[model samples]
Target chain A: MISVAVDAYGGDHAPQEVIKGIEFALRENSDLFVYLVGKEGELKGFIKGFEDSFRKRINIVDAPQVVRMSDKPSQALRLKNSSMAVGINLVKEGKADAFMTAGNSGAAMALAMFTLGRIKGVSRPAIATLLPTLEGQMLMLDVGANVDCKPQHLLEFSIMGYVYAKHVAGIDNPRVAVLSNGSEPGKGNQLTLSSYDLLSKSRLNFIGNIEGDEIYKGRADVVVCDGFVGNVVLKVSESIPDLIIEFLKEEIKRSFWYKIGFLLAKPAFRVLKSKTDYSSFGGAPLLGVRGSCIISHGRSNGVAIKNAILKAVKFSKEKVNDKIESAMEGCFVLKELKGAVRT
Target chain B: MISVAVDAYGGDHAPQEVIKGIEFALRENSDLFVYLVGKEGELKGFIKGFEDSFRKRINIVDAPQVVRMSDKPSQALRLKNSSMAVGINLVKEGKADAFMTAGNSGAAMALAMFTLGRIKGVSRPAIATLLPTLEGQMLMLDVGANVDCKPQHLLEFSIMGYVYAKHVAGIDNPRVAVLSNGSEPGKGNQLTLSSYDLLSKSRLNFIGNIEGDEIYKGRADVVVCDGFVGNVVLKVSESIPDLIIEFLKEEIKRSFWYKIGFLLAKPAFRVLKSKTDYSSFGGAPLLGVRGSCIISHGRSNGVAIKNAILKAVKFSKEKVNDKIESAMEGCFVLKELKGAVRT
Candidate 1:
């Protein structure tokens, strides 16, 4: 059994939905053990409904403090170890195989860095998330971690992300790309230009630079960039679908004819909404860390929290740490290959 | 009669749809003169079907130069006395009330600045596009003009965007917001924090910072930011709906029942599509310029072009320049207020 520590207070739904999501995840993998961390009272209130065997298998660690959505990343991190941080420490101490939290992502990264520690060759750990596009879901890393990233850092992110895609996402020889303003070899900011050279020289199948518009085109399986731009892209990817839906609703509401028409399209609307759902995919995996930790949205539901734990369970079994280490062991051979071609 | 210069070879459709759009605009306003700029051969081929009255109204300026979308912004501006440049020069020369193009936006901004200087107190101009949200269309500025902008530049963009929203979009006391990572007093990057202070101090009804998700919530009528974020938002806003539409299409194609159901809900789909229609709003307006210049989509049709021209006509008569100059005159007051607040 790959035991995982889950912060029950991390998400908006908190212990209630998070516990329920854990229940669902437990159903999928009967051998999975969850370490629920939060306020004893809140955690107990939700845990009361489960059976004795389930209760026996599940565990709780008291953590009264909470980090709010309004708190600064650094300020939140400084608090005397919230349930999320404590849960991460459990993984670092080898009490759990992996760590999961439907909590503040910034805090998650900080805790992972402080407790679990960064990989040997990795500069800063990156948080990658899956984007369900027209073709299929692709991996986009450094989504909101490490805003000011070096070119070498991006190369490592690409390697780690490439491995995740190949093993976890079942993508064979994933097409890795350095996200940029354009697809040209010489395109993008200074950071991306140098990263492009490193990526092109690597043994990993390196695609040329991918543009923002073509991100969803499914041209590249693994797309990498710094946190700032990546965060914008990630946020935009989520927001635009919502904007479209709202605009459609408003346009329909303006006229009676459109209102009646909207009712007919309800099923299709549900289907469209379903495609954008990332909750089932669990939280973002903090790669290049010694231990496994999946960071979910703070406002996540029971299922999303559960999915995060499920991802943690997978991370433990898949040997993500070993894979990331192996990927980083080599010098960017792709860089040498890339230098051969004209810029 | 508001005479405007229309670059005939400006967009993807160019002379053909642009001329048709011009005709559509002329249909609404009988007294309109257009100086069509393009290659003589291409211009003749496009205008062949129009009547002599239409022919008489439009003065064709034969220029053997064509501006490409891929051309660098610097190169487009440096094309010493090119057709696009010459057309813009007409606006600067006071021969036209406004200029319209659907071509390279970078080149357009470069030429607009070099040819027609910024308003006196305005430090920089921004591209303000109408976003079709549930609360009706909101004006979003700096879509693509300035790449890396300072807080001062964003503040100027906000004021100009506010004017465009209030005067052209007809929003009385438009609620303006600076897009940020969060909706708080002290949130987002350094640029937003500084811009927030400047905007809050202004007479324009400045709402505080808004998160990316709140965009669909209709939190404000004018969302201002630097061009990089603005362009990313705009492009994402354009792409996501199509992505959803594609998903729905494939889903419906799975079975005959789904296909039949889709047929029933065709009207609803149309309603949703109309909500996200960038064309309904036509091109974005280039604010802080001496003259009204509309930048339409490269993929715009004659109808969209016509609507764009009509919108430009409103700005031209609204005496946007007069209002902007008056706003700029108050810069000294604002600077003094900022100083007072600091002390």
Candidate 2:
């Protein structure tokens, strides 16, 4: 059984949605086992109606402390018995194959780094999330992790993204790119310019630079950027569909014809909405951490949570971390950087 | 009469659309005279059928060399007699009150700085463009000028944006903000952190950091960012409407109901398209320069070009450059930086 530790008291929906997610995941994956990390009493009460078959797969782990979303990472780190911390600890202690949380992303990353540590040769862990592209999904890294990243760190993100795309997403020979203001090699700031050179020299199928507009075109399988830019881009992209819908609604109110048209086109709009929906993608993986750590959106629902659990199981089963370590070992630039640092 | 220098050979539509734009602008403003700089023979051929009254307001200046959109800024700078260069020269020599182009933005900035020079105490010129928000519009600066910027540059952008918003855009006590990953003061990279401190200490109506998603909410009148981030954000935002349309089209084809709905809502979609249209905004102003310069999109049509000419005239009439110079004088950060550099 691929055992997973889930933070039940995390995210906006909290213990209720998390319980539903665990029940859904258990029904789907017969071989999956879960340690529901939260207040034991609350979790037990929620699962009281579960059948013997479902109950057999779930075990409650008492984590009396709850980390609030607004709490600083420092404050969260001190709460060692928090659900998020306990779930990560289960992975660290080899009791669970992976850990999933829809809680405070900052707290989750802090705890994961503190408990699980970084993969060898990885300077900083990055959050890798899937963005919908014209052709398929593209993985974008450092979405909210390392805000200030060196060129080497970006290179590491590319390697991790490449492995994830190839192994998990099932893309063959993923094309990696540095997300920049312009697609041209010379058309970036100091950081991207330096990163472009490092990426070009790497063994990964490194396509040059990709502009923001080209991101949705699916020209690159993996797009790497500093956390600040990635986070901004992701949030900005997320805001677009809703803004369009809002604009459409305002326009519809202007005329009777528009109202009728909107009603007919409602199905198409629903499809468009579902296609751009964040919940469908499950969660972003905190790549380069020592264990499998999936961080879902704070607003994630039961469906999203279930998908995240499935994704974590797949990640653990594929042994993505081992592949990343081997890939880092093969990277000459990383070796050179390490040599320079040691000297 | 407010005389304007028009780069007749710049942009995609060139002499044809430019002549039409000149005609339109002349009709809108009786006091406007235009110096249409381009190859004399080609420009004359296009305007041969214009009525005497319209023809009287235009003067053709011979500029044999043309700067192609693909040309590098350095390459463009060497074309001393190109339409873009000659037109800018008109402003530098006080022959025209303003210059407008739909050509290479980098070339426009380089030529404008090289010929007209910077406003006193200004370190660099920035491109400020208006973005449609829920309430009205917000001005975002450094869209594609200086990619890499220091905290002082951001401070200068805020001051310039503030002045423009107050004087030209007619916003009272404009609220200026630094764009960052998070809305919180400390939630940013090294650059934004330093910039936030500088902005908070400034005399402008400085609001705290605004995230990417919050940009469209119209919380602040002016948003300041380094050109790299701003360029990416602008391009990414520009791509959204078209992407949504593409997704909607794909969905519409999947069902008969959607097709019927799309036809009915076609007018509403058109309204949405026009509202999001870049042409309606005319052009981005190259702020902090000594002369009034407006850089239109390369894909500008006659209507866009005309609007840009009107905007340039408004900018000149408002004495924006003079206001920016005075604003810089009042800035303590710029004065302190200058003092430290002198020592």
Candidate 3:
């Protein structure tokens, strides 16, 4: 049975959705167990409300403090007994196979770095977000982990993204590319230019630089960039569909014929929304840490939380950390790249 | 009457679209004149095809060479008699009110900076692109002019974007925001972190940091970032609708009902397409240069080229360059930020 620890007092929905998600996960996967890490008194009554047989599988651990969404990562770190900290400790102590949280993302990353630490040869841990493409989904890394990253950090992100795409997503050979203004190998800022050289020499299937317009056209399975660019790309892409729909609504309201057309095309719009929904992917994995860590959105609901739990379970079963550690050992250039910080 | 010099031997459509665009512009606007800059032998026959009344207003200026899209800006600069160079010279020599090109953007920007120079205190010239929002269009600057930029460069972009938004876009008290990972002032990488500080103290209608997801929500009238981030955001946003349509077509094919739905909603999709189309905006203006220079896409068509010519006429009539030069003079902080190159 795979064991998972979840931060009960995390996310906008919090204990309500987190509790529903755990119940759903347990019902969906019979061989899975969970440790609810949060305020014991508050959560005990919630768990007791479920079926007696389901209640037997859940163990509530007391984490008196709660990390508010507004709190900074540094402030959250000071709360050693908080749900975010205690949940990470569960994975670090080997009491749980994986840790899942929808709590403060910066706090989660900070706690993971402080407690579980980096996997053997990994230089920087990155957040790998699964973005939908025309054909399927692509993996974009360093989403917000390290905003300012060195070329070597990007090389490591590419490697980690390659491994996760191969193992988790099951692509035979993932096509990897660095994001740039132009598609040419020489067309990029300083960070991408250096990362391009490192990626070219690596064992992975590294394609030349990819322009932003080619990202969703299914040009590459893995797109690597520093966290700053990656974050902007992810957020901008997320915002477009909503913006388009808003514009379409206004256009429809202008004409009686357009409103009728919108009604007829409701099914097609539903399919589009479902395909782009983040809840389908569950959550993004925080790669390069010693323990398995899955970080979901702050506003994530029950379904999103459930998917995140499943992703964590998959991460544990695949031994992704072991594979990453082994992959890092083979990266000969990382030795020289150590402590190379580029502002 | 505003006279606009257009590079005839530019873009994929070349003299065909360029000539067609000139005809369209002349037909639309009665008070406009154009100097068709390219090889006289190739363009004279094209101009002769127009009506005698229309032909009377068009003049052909012979530029012996054409700047290829692949040619380096430095290499293109050597050809002083090329269409790109001669067109810029028309504006610099006061022969034409504005210079417009659908040719090499890099070459156009380089020639503009070389010939026109900066607008007094301006450290680096920027390209301001009009991106569609739910309400209307917003201005995003430094699209690809400078790949790497300091905080001061971003500050200058904000000021220029504000002036353009107020004068050209006709927005009263335009809200300006710097692009960052989060909406908070302190939440960003080193570049944005420092930029946030400078922007907060600027005289412009500075709204705090804006996340990428909020860019198209009409959260701010002007969004500021380094050229690298701006280019990626622009290109990625441009590519998304195509990807969405491709996916929708595939989804539609999966069922007969979906196809029917797609057919009914064709009008709404058409409206959406027109709103997002780059051709509607014509071209991005290279701001902060001494003279008004408009750069269109290499793949721009007849309609796009025509719109670019119209945009150049508007830029010239607005005296945007003069306003920018005056704006730069009031910026007291720019003196210290003159040579601040981060990378």
Candidate 4:
């Protein structure tokens, strides 16, 4: 049975939703076990609400402190007895196969790096999030981690994203492209321009540069960019559906006929919402780390948490970290080749 | 009478839409006269198709060359006899009040800088595009002008964007903000982190940092960023409706009920499209230059071209350049104070 560490006191709807998510995940996957890490007294009450069968699969690990949302990563790191740190420790101590949290993202990253550590040959770990597009879903990496990146960092991200998309996303020879201002090979600023040359020469299926407008057109399986640019793109795309709905609400209020049309078109709107919904993807995987760690949305509910647990289960089973390490070996040889070409 | 220089052979629709746009602008504003800059024979043929009364207001300048979209800005600059150059020359000689083009944006910027030059105290010019939001329209600058910008350049953009929003956009004391990964002050990469500090002490109504998602939330009247981030946001937002509509089309085709709902909600959809349409705002203005220049879409139709011409007229009449020059002076004084604080 696969074991997963769950930060039971992480998200906005913690304890309650975290307990519910554990139950939901246990129901969906029979061959799974969970170590629910949180305050013993608070979790015991919610644990009592669940059935005996679910309680049998779950084990509570006592963690006295909680990491507040506003707490800095440095402060959270000092809290050795915190729920986030204890859960990550379970993964490090071989008590769990993966760690899942919806709590302070920076803290989670810090704990993962401090505990399980980065994969061999990986300089920095990155967060990869899935975005919805017309052609289906595409993976974008460095969403909020590693704000300032060099050309080599982006090259590593492309390799890591390629491995994740291939093994986890289940695409054969995933098409990888760097996010740029224009689609042309020579386009983009300093970082993307140098990364483009490296990505093109790498062993992965690099498909040159892709413009921002082409992202939703399902152009590439994996799109690579700096964390700052990727974060902006992710946030902008996330806000589109809500902004559209808000605009439509105002438009419908203006005329009587439009109101009736909106009522009838509610199903179509539901479909659009489902396509762009975050709950379906569950969490963003902190790629390049030694162990599987999924950081979920802060506002995530039971369903989102459950989906994240399922994703963690799949990621552990895929042995993506092993593949990432090997990919970096190949990347090192390519770097040598690039150096040779320069001389 | 206000004389506007129109590039007859610039966009995909070329001399045709250019002439139609001139006709449309002339009809809209009686005080407008157009210098149709293109090959003499081609423009005269189109001008001949119009009535004698309309033809009287149109003057054709013989320019035998055209700047291809693929040509480099440097290469286009060498084409002294090109329509883009001829049109900009008209503005330089005071033969035209403002210049309008649907040509290569880089070429247009280069020509404007090469001919009219930057305003006094302005480090570099920027392109400002108006975007639709819940709180009506807001302006975003440096869309694609300077891909790599310093803290000082962004500070200049904020000043210029502030002046344009105040004068042309008609907002009193517009709320100006810098775009970052988060709304907090210390939440961006190296560039935005320094820019946040600089913008806070400027003379304009600076409102700290804003995230990408908050842009459409009607958070600020003028949003500033490096051209790269601004371009990506502009293109992504511009493509959102198309992607949504494409996704909706597939969803509607999946079921009969959805198809009917879409048909009924067609009016509401029209309202949504009109609100987000770029044609409504005419075109992006190349701000901070010595003279007014409007860069329209390459795929501009007659209506879009006409609106661009009208926008150029208003921009010139408003004397936004004069205001931009003065704004930069205020910015210089503020920079001195900042430098003094450092010492």
Per-model TM-score, in order, reads: 0.92, 0.92, 0.94, 0.93
Q: What DockQ, on C-alphas, does every prediction get? A: 0.40, 0.66, 0.67, 0.63
Best by DockQ: 3
* lDDT ranking, best first: 2, 3, 4, 1
List ranges where model 4 is wrong by over 4 Å.
A12-20, A66-76, A331-343, B12-16, B46-48, B331-343
Q: TM-score of chain B, candidate 2?
A: 0.94
Weakest ten-residue segment in model 1 chain B by summed lDDT: B334-343
Worst 10-residue lDDT window for candidate 4 chain B reads B334-343
- Please give the lDDT score for candidate 3: 0.86
Q: What is the lDDT of residue B266 in candidate 4?
A: 85
**Which window of 10 residues has the lowest lDDT sum in candidate 2 chain B?**
B334-343
Q: Give i-RMS (Å) per prediction.
A: 3.0, 1.4, 1.5, 1.5
Better of 1 and 4 by DockQ: 4
lDDT of 4 by residue, A8-41 (tens): 9898889788788889999999988999999988
Which ranges of candidate 1 are over 4 A from the true structure?
A148-153, A178-206, A246-265, A331-343, B184-187, B197-204, B331-333, B337-343
For candidate 2, write residues B171-191 as lDDT tens digits: 999999999987766588888
- Summarize candidate 3's per-residue lDDT along B224-260 as a digit string, tens digits: 9998999899899988888778877877888776677
Off by over 4 Å in 3: A68-72, A331-343, B331-343
Tell me how large the interface RMSD of candidate 2 is: 1.4
Sorted into a CAPRI-style docking class, model 3 comes out as medium
Candidate 1, residue B136: lDDT: 69
TM-score of chain B of each: 0.92, 0.94, 0.94, 0.94
Q: Each prediction's Cα lDDT score?
A: 0.77, 0.88, 0.86, 0.85
Which ten residues in a row are the worst by lDDT in model 3 chain A? A334-343
Tell me, per candidate, how large a share of the native contacts it keeps: 0.33, 0.70, 0.73, 0.61
